[model samples]
Target: MSLSALLFPSDAMAQQSGIKRIDLQRHDLSVFGYETVQARIDFEPGTAFGMHSHPGEEVIYVLEGLLECKFQ
Candidate 1:
């Protein structure tokens, strides 16, 4: 799957849920079959994303507000 597909909600869902995603950069890694993706995601108050997982490592930095995360 594409990076956007893995990291973002569907367009219709995002519109309905007041979520916005801005892709900052995407680059292929030196290792074959690996890549890195950077993005800025904004969520309106009370908005929440569904459960999902990524293929590679993920790093998140929240600019402001409370963010709750769950992991298995």
Candidate 2:
């Protein structure tokens, strides 16, 4: 598994909550029988991501604020 950090915000956040996203880098790699993708999703947030999911596996780290997540 790989871990990553992001500050992605919702569309409404950009206009209403003063959020922004800065994509620093993105790439895909395959090794043996595994595939991996690396990306950066930077944002300035004044709101929270309501509901979301990603393909395969995901790891996230937050720099500030609080995160409430529900998985089913």
lDDT of each: 0.64, 0.45
lDDT, candidate 2, 1-72, per-residue tens: 112344333244335443454445444546454344433433444444456554456557655555555777
What pairs collide in candidate 1? Answer: none
Clashing pairs in 2: none
Model 1 / residue 5 / CA error / Å? 14
Alpha-carbon TM-score of each model against the true structure: 0.74, 0.47
lDDT per residue for candidate 1 within 2-21, as digits (tens), equals: 12322443355446556777
What TM-score does model 1 achieve against the real structure? 0.74
Best by TM-score: 1
How well does candidate 2 match the true structure, expressed as C-alpha RMSD?
6.3
Candidate 1 deviates by what RMSD? 5.7
Off by over 4 Å in 1: 1-16
